[model samples]
Target chain A: MVAESARENKRVLEVKNLKLHYLTSQGAVKAVDDISFCLNRGETLGIVGESGCGKTTTAVALMMMPSPPGKIVGGQILIEGKDIVPMTETQIRKQIRWEKISMVFQGAMNCLTPVYTIGKQMMETLREHREMAKEEAIARIEKYLAYVGLSRDVLKRYPHELSGGMKQRIVIAMALFLEPKIILCDEPTTALDVVVQAQIINLLKDLKQQLDLSFIFITHDLATEAEVSDRLMVMYGGKIAEIGTNEQIYGKQGPMHPYTQRLLKATPLLHEKVEELAFIPGRPPDLLNPPKGCKFHDRCNVVMDRCKEEEPDLREVEPDHFVSCWRCRES
Target chain B: MSENIFEAKNLQKWFPVRRSITDLLKRRQSYVKAVDGVTFSIRRGEIFGLVGESGCGKTTTGKMLMKLLEPTGGQMLLDGQDVTHITAERLKTYRREVQMVFQDPYASMNPRFRIRDVLEEPLLIHKVGEDHQERLKMVARALTEVRLQPPEEYMERFPHMLSGGQRQRAATARSLILNPKFIVADEPVSMIDLSTRAEILHMMKQVQRELQLTYLYITHDLSTARYFTDTIAVMYLGRIVEMGDPDDVIDHPRHPYTMALIAAVCEPVSGKVNRIKDVPIKGEVPSAQNIPRGCRFHPRCLYAKEECWTQIEPELEIVEGRHWVACRRYKEI
Candidate 1:
C-alpha cells in the first residue's frame, strides 16, 4: 500500500475521460471516446490495439497537434498536476510541446527532413527550444549522438546516408534532446528488421533507466510491448477495454477481456507450439458508427445479451487490474 | 524425382548496378548478387519456406521460381522438365503451371477492375474454357476455395471496396483460377493484421491441400515461417546458409545468422525481454552489392576466425539427417 501511494505521487501524466472526434462528412467519428489513464514518472505505459482503434489518435491528442478533421472534443490532460486541456495555443506551443512532451513518429524516413543535414536538423530543435548558440548546440548534439551510440561524423551526413536503425536512434535522440518528461513512441520498430528491432528496444530500455524518462509506447505488437512497458492498456474500437500490470495482462490466462484474450491467443509465440491459433472471428467495430453497447460484443465468445444492451464500465476486478466486462466482474 | 514437382539447381541472379559517367570512364562494373547459387527442391505438395531479411534475396528467389525474373545462371525444372531453355510458347505453358501471389495485396491488383475481372483475366489469358460463362463458374469455384463465400456479393465489388484480407484472398483466388501446380506466395500475410493473418494462412494451407499445390512461401518473419512451412531454408546475403525441419532450424539454429534471426524475434512473453544476449553479431546488414569476402556473414559472425576471411567459400555440408549448414565452424558449433 505504501509503494502504491509512492507510485501515485510519481504520476507524471494523467489523461482523464479524454475524448477526441473527427468531423467527417458522414458524421462525427468518435476516434477516442472517454479514455483515461495515468503514466507514472519513469514508467512505460504501453497502449496496444488494432488499426483504427484510436491508439494513434490518443497519442496525437497528447501532442496537441491541429490535425485537420481531428479535434479534441473534451477531457482533462493533466501533466505534472496542471490541466493542459484549457491552455491557450501559444502557451501549449511555448511550454507544453517538446518542453514537457515530444513524439517519435512511426517511420524515420518520413520524420527526418530529407534536405537538411543531421547537425542542421538537431541545431534547429535546440535553437528553437533552448535558444542555444550554434557552437553550443553542435556540442550538445555530439553529446546526444554519443549517448545514442552514433559517431559525431554522422553529423555531416544527410538522412539518406544513415541506415534505418541509425535513423531511428537519431530520431530518439532528437526527442530526448529536449529532455521532456514523457516521450510518445508510435510504432517505433515496425519498419525495422528483427535484429535491428531488438537493438532499438534495448536502446530504449537503457535510455529510460539512465534518464528516468516516462514513455507512452504505442504498438500493435503485444510481445514487443511486454518487453518495455510496466503497464498495458488494450483498446478496441474507440474505448480502452482493459488496463493492468504487465504480469496481470500477460500472465497465464490473465487477460480478462475476451478481446484481449483472443488477441493474445491470435499472436504466434516463438517458444510455444499450438495446433492452431484462435483468431477473433469478426473485424474491429466501425468507429464511424460504433456499436450500441460493448464495442467487442460481436466478437466476444462469452458475450451475453446484457453486453449488447449495456456498456460495462472499466471496473477494478483485482488489485491493479481493470476489465470492462460484466462476466469478468461477476467471476 | 516423381515426388519432386519443382527444383531449382544452383540458381543465380546478379543485378547490374547503374554506373555513373565517372564509372563509365573508368570502365568499372558492379553487380548485386541477389541470388547466389541457391539450390532447393519442393515436393508435390510441400510448403518450402525461404526465410531471410530484406536484402537476403528471398523475394528474388521466389520471383525466379515464378519466372517473373530470369536467372543469370543455373536452371529450373518443372515436372522433371528443363525450363531455362524452353521456347516462348513452352514458357507460357510453364507459367500456366506456376503462379505467384505478391506481398502487397493493394498494389498487386487493378483498382479499376471488379473482382470478377481480376479472377477471370487469368482464365481469359490462358484460354481455360470455351465460353465466358464457363470462366465465370471457374471464378466462383476459385472464390469459394479461398473461403470468400457468397461469391455473387464480392464479384461486382472493386478492389478498393474490399479490406486487406479480402483483397489478398481475391488475389489468391485469381492465382488458383489457372489451376497451377506450384505457387510462389511472397509474404502474402505480412501486410495484413495479425488477427487476419492466421485466417489467410489457414485459407492458403487449405487451398494447397485441396488442390495439391506446391508452395514456395517466402517471408522475413521466422515465426510465421516455422508455423507455415514444412522444410525451412535460412538465407543470408543472397545465400542459403541453413536448411532443415522448421522446428529443428528455429529451435536449435546452427548458422550464426539463423541463431541471430531466431534470437531477435521480439516475443510477447514476460521475462523473455533480455533473453537474447549480444545479438550474436555487430552492425546492420551490409549492402548486398559489397558482400564480404569468403563467407558472406564473416564480418558479422561472432565466431569468425582469421581463416574465415581468407578461406575459400564454404559449401553447405549436411550436419545431421537432411539438416544442412554452410558455416565453417559447423563441427565445433
Candidate 2:
C-alpha cells in the first residue's frame, strides 16, 4: 500500500479506461476507446497517430470539453488523486479545467481574437478564472510571454499584426497564465515553418524543465513527437497500439507493434540513408465501423489467423514497454 | 533537341502591391518580388526540387515554368526553344508537353466530374485521342499506369468517393494522360496522410522513371525533398541560395539558410527527446515586398557581417563539382 502511494505521487495525471464517443448520423464514432496511461511529473508523453486516430480527441477529452456530439462515455481522469470524471460541467470548469490541467490546441494561433489586443484577450482568460488585479495579471502575462521568447510589445498588437510563429508563442503563453502543472499540447507546431517549429519545440522543452511541468504532446508528425516525448504512445483507430520509452520504441531493437514499426518506416528521415520507405497498404480505419478484432489488423504486415478472431490486450512485452499485438503475445 | 529538357534563366515574377495614398501622391510603386532572378536548368528525365518555406516564392517559380503565370522578366527555354511569352496558340502546344500536379488533389479536381472525366478533359483539351471511345480507352490506360487498377471501377467514382491517396493517384493519372515531357509537382503529398505519403511519392517516382519524365518538384519539407529528388535548390526570399545534389545540399549544406533549414528538420530517430535544438537563424522571414538590401538573408543570418548587407549581393558560385552556394561568406562560415 505504501509503494502504491509512492507510485501515485510520481504520476501527475492518470487516465484509466477512458472512452470517448462521437455520435454521428451513421453511428457512434469510437474516437477514444478504453485507453489507459499515466503521465509522470515533468515527463512529456508524445501521442502519435494518423488523422482521426484520436490523438486530438484524447487531448480534448482530458480537458473535459469534447465538442458537441462527442461525449465521455466512461473512464476516470485522475489528476493528483482527484477523480475529475464524476465532476459536473460547472464544477469541472471551475475547479478542474485550467486549474490542474490546461491545453494548447491545434492551430491555436488562429484562436486569438482579431478585435482584441493580445493583452486584453489574455487578461480576459485570467479574469474569467481567478480573482486577480489587472496589473498583477498583466505582469504575469508579460512574464510568461517572455518565457516563450516574446517581447512585451506583443501584448499591444492584434493577432493579424504578428506572424504565425509569434502568434503560436502567444498561445503557449496563454496556456501558462494559470500556472497549470500539466499542459496538453495538440499539434502545437503543425502548420508553422520548419525553423519556427524548432524554436517552438525548444521553447516547450525549456519551459518543461524550468516550470517542472508535465506535457501530453500530441502530433501526427512522428519525428517532431520523438523530439519532445519522454515516453511515446502510438494510437490506432481509438486504442493504444503501443507505448514505451524512446529507446524501446525507436532503438535498434525497433518497435514491436506492426503499426508503430510501419509508421516509423513510412516517415522520411534526414540524417539517415533509406533505400526505400515502407508504406501501410490500406487506409486508416473508419471509426464508425472499425474492423473486427484488432483495429490495426487490416493493415498489419505480420497478421496471424488468431489476430483476426480475438483482440489482444495491451500486454507488457518488456519492462515498461507495452504492445497490443497477437504476435507479441505469441512471442 | 538539347539534353536539358527545361531551363529557366534569371526568371523574375514581381507582383505589384497596391499603392497607398501617400505612395500614390509621391509617385512611388512597390512590388512583391515573388521569384526574384532564379536561374536553374532541369536535365532530361531528372527530378529537380525547388525547396523553401512559404512566401519564399517556390510556387511562383513553378507556375512560371508551367506557363500558368507569365514571367515578368527572364527567359524560359523548352527543348532549346525560347518560350517565355509564347502566343496562346503556341502555349496550348507547350502546355501539352508540360503538365502540373497541384498540392491539394481535393481542391484541384472538379467535384462533379468522375475520374474518367477528369482524365479525359486533359486529353480532350490537348486533342490527344481521335474520338470519345478512343479517349475513354486512353483514360483507362492512364489509370492502369498509375496502378489504380481495375481502371473501370475507379473511373466511375467522383473525387469525393475516392480516398485521399486514391484521389492523388487519380490526379497524377490526369497529369499523365497527356503524356507530358516535363511535370511540375508542387507539394503534391503535403495534404495526404502520413502513412500514405510515401505511397504517393513512390508511385510518382515510379511513373517518373518509367516514362523518362523530367519533374520540377517543389516543396517546403526537406526530408521529402531529400528522399524524392535527384537535385535540390534551396531558395530564400525568392532567390536560389544553394543548389546541388540532394546529398550535398541536405547533408553538407553550404549556405547559412540551407544549414538552418536542415538543422530545423525534426529527425524521427529516437533518443533525441528533450535535447535542446538550436535553430541558428533568428527572426521570421521578412515580407517579400520589403526584401533586405544586399544579402536578402542578412537580417536573420547569425554570421552576417557589415559587408553581407552593405556590399553587392553574392551570386551563385561553384563550390565544387555540381555544388553551388550564393553566400559570399560560405568559405569563412
| Top candidate by lDDT | 2
Q: Tens-digit lDDT track for model 1 on B1-333? A: 588998889999999999999989999989999998988888889999999888899999888887788899998989898886667888788888899999999999999999999999988888898898998899999999998889988999999988889999999999999888999999999888877788899889888888888999999888778788899999988899999988888888899889888888877776644233357777778888898999889888889988888998798889899789998987786
TM-score of chain B, candidates 1 onward in order: 0.96, 0.98
Can you list each candidate's DockQ?
0.60, 0.77
Interface RMSD of each: 2.0, 1.2
User: Across residues A187-274, which tens digit of lDDT does each residue of candidate 2 receive?
Assistant: 9998898999999999999999999999999999888987899999999999999999988887889899999998999999987667
Per-residue lDDT for A231 in model 2?
93
Error of model 2, residue B270, in angstroms:
2.7
What does candidate 1's lDDT look like per residue over A1-331, in tens digits? 7977787788999899999999999998999999988998888899999888999999999989849798899999999989999999999989999889999998865788989998888888789888777888888898888888899988899999889999999999999888787999999999888899889888888888888899999999887888878899999888989998888877775788888888888888876666676677668888888888888888888989999999998988888788899889877
Docking quality tier of candidate 2?
medium
Which candidate has the top score in DockQ? Answer: 2
lDDT (tens digit, per residue) of candidate 2 on B270-310:
77887999878978899998999999999999999999999
lDDT of 1 at A117: 93
Q: lDDT of candidate 1 vs native?
A: 0.88
